[model samples]
Target: MSVQAPRWRAMRVSDLPAASAVAARVHPGYPEDDAVMAERLRLCPEGCLALAGPGDLPFGYAVGHPWRSGSVPDLDTLVGALPVPAGAWCIHDVALLPEARGHGAAGEVVGLMLGEAARRGLPEAVLVAVGDAAGFWQRHGFRPVPIAAPAGYGAGATVMVRSLAP
Candidate 1:
């Protein structure tokens, strides 16, 4: 059977359940805590986007916000370690449902996020990637920063950055 390309758009309050469901399916082992996800859904509604197939069933999603150094310890520390420009975007998380893997959904999501960052006049974007996804982010122009440990992602995560047109 052939899978259809999912329709992607900015997420809304109504999309919370569907987005959460997709997130759960995508990151089963590291399921986002409900409270944190709820806050993200509430505060940065436009920062969240969803990819859905027929019937609007979510197949993937990407969530991010203006990288506020004060809000994240590791990110703040990482920022201190680098000589980045004044303003940069930070991507908190991006995930695709298992069924949607290998279909370039993640790239689409990243593209959208980067486009948004560009639209906001940000010059660069950063993210902490987990698992074997380091190579994936690399393909999107993200380069790893030499750090002892991933700041916001914890443990062995790798921190990556991509420059966007200012």
Candidate 2:
């Protein structure tokens, strides 16, 4: 019999550690610290998502919030607060374990985020594609932007943006 896929759900206060585990596994260098992840959840729990498997740990996690598009948030640090009139939806972190890769799960999670952006009346979505993952974001309709990535994100880190469908 074929195995079932994990289900996507809103990230809650209880999922912090599991989410951190997944982030640490997928993003070893640019670790999104537990405190930073919690801050993102606080900024917009509705935008943060977790893929729950049969076990306690999450299969993947996508954390984000609406923020000003002119700048990117620091790597692995706390964003004290989102701007009062955030202009675009910023995808802060997305991580998936090996078993969760090459599946439709990531795309589905991004769809949920885009839907949230549209619902919030945000015109755009932005993210810093690390390493060679720019192609993945490009496939999702995000094009490279001139915005500079913050220090510690590595040399290949580049900002990308796309308009959300209203």
Best by lDDT: 2
The sequence of per-residue lDDT tens digits that candidate 2 reaches over residues 1-166 is 7666787898888998888888788888886658888888888999888888876458889987989965678788877888879889998878889988887888988888888888889889999999788998999999998878988698979999998754
Query: Candidate 1 residues 2-73, lDDT tens each?
Result: 766787887766777877787677666555655555565565566788788767777777877666432222
Off by over 4 Å in 1: 1-4, 69-86, 148-152
Q: By summed lDDT, which 10 consecutive residues of candidate 2 come out lowest?
A: 69-78
In terms of lDDT, the poorest run of 10 residues in model 1 is 75-84
Report, for all candidates in order, the number of backbone clashes: 1, 0
Once model 2 is optimally superposed onto the true structure by TM-score, how far is the C-alpha of residue 89 displaced, in angstroms?
A: 0.1
TM-score of 1: 0.79
lDDT of 1: 0.69
Q: Candidates' TM-scores?
A: 0.79, 0.94
How displaced is residue 117 in candidate 2, in Å? 0.4
User: In candidate 2, how many Å is residue 80 off?
Assistant: 1.3
- Residue 103 C-alpha lDDT in model 1: 73
